[model samples]
Target: MFKHLLPRLRERSIAAKRPVSLADMMEEFWREPFASLAPVFRDGGYPAVDVSETEGVVTVRAELPGLEPADVSISVENDALILRGEKKFEGEEKKDDYHRIERAYGSFSRLIPLPGKVKEAEAKARFDKGVLTVTLPRDAAEAARNIPIEGA
Candidate 1:
């Protein structure tokens, strides 16, 4: 009956030995009241992305399964690339019996910072087989240039 007390005692003993900061105490004070509701505010980082630079272009690819191209929007603002989209829930069929539904459906927005300036007018995006590919060509002024070394 008292087996659980051992673990609690050990935990308290271990915790008492460590130095605690004011910030840690404050965080614990605030966390206990909202710990049960924490899951509701979690961001799962949906629609994962990959950003790569090759030659004179920067490319970004996002995984958006089960969503049409029309459901998403892409924009470049203030040197950051923004991706916004919503995956609406499908109407449940009366005959379908489901045990568990883990798929996430909702609106999400992701802002990606670019390494260098890009030509927004020349930017192109394509969606194929649940993947979005965006290519932004680097601006002429932002391109890499070889500097000549002068011997004095």
Candidate 2:
């Protein structure tokens, strides 16, 4: 039960857009019958995303601090951009707890909806300064075009 749930809970909470408290979590644990199976969003999500479309391309920038290229994976599947990665907490030693511990480490996955058709083989990804930028070149046929306003 809890053995498999803790990880999921942590991931969901981290993915949440707003902060969730311990009491809230406890209340959810007791009241929500589907809590275990539900996706929870608490706040301070991982790998925050910024997406934009311009110049025949869709750009996705995700912040992945403390992660290496090998720790992340990006792929295109059926008009969707999938991002998968894991953030590990390296080393744990006994420490005096007088303050606060807020950093979270775990696996995260986000599926972004594509703005247009993309050439998967022509896509490019680069990682620098803990940020992963993926650019998907849009298909020529699917590129956006401006419509000139015609006054009659």
- The local distance difference test score of model 2 is 0.82
Candidate 1 error regions (>4 Å): 3-44, 144-152
C-alpha lDDT score of every prediction, in listed order: 0.84, 0.82
The TM-score of predicted model 1 comes to 0.66
lDDT for each residue of candidate 1 in 70-107, tens digit (9 for 90 to 100): 99999999888999999999888889899978788899
Question: Please, what is the TM-score per model?
Answer: 0.66, 0.63
Model 2, 42-83: lDDT tens digits are 333456889998878899999898999999999999899988
Best by lDDT: 1
The TM-score between candidate 2 and the true structure equals 0.63
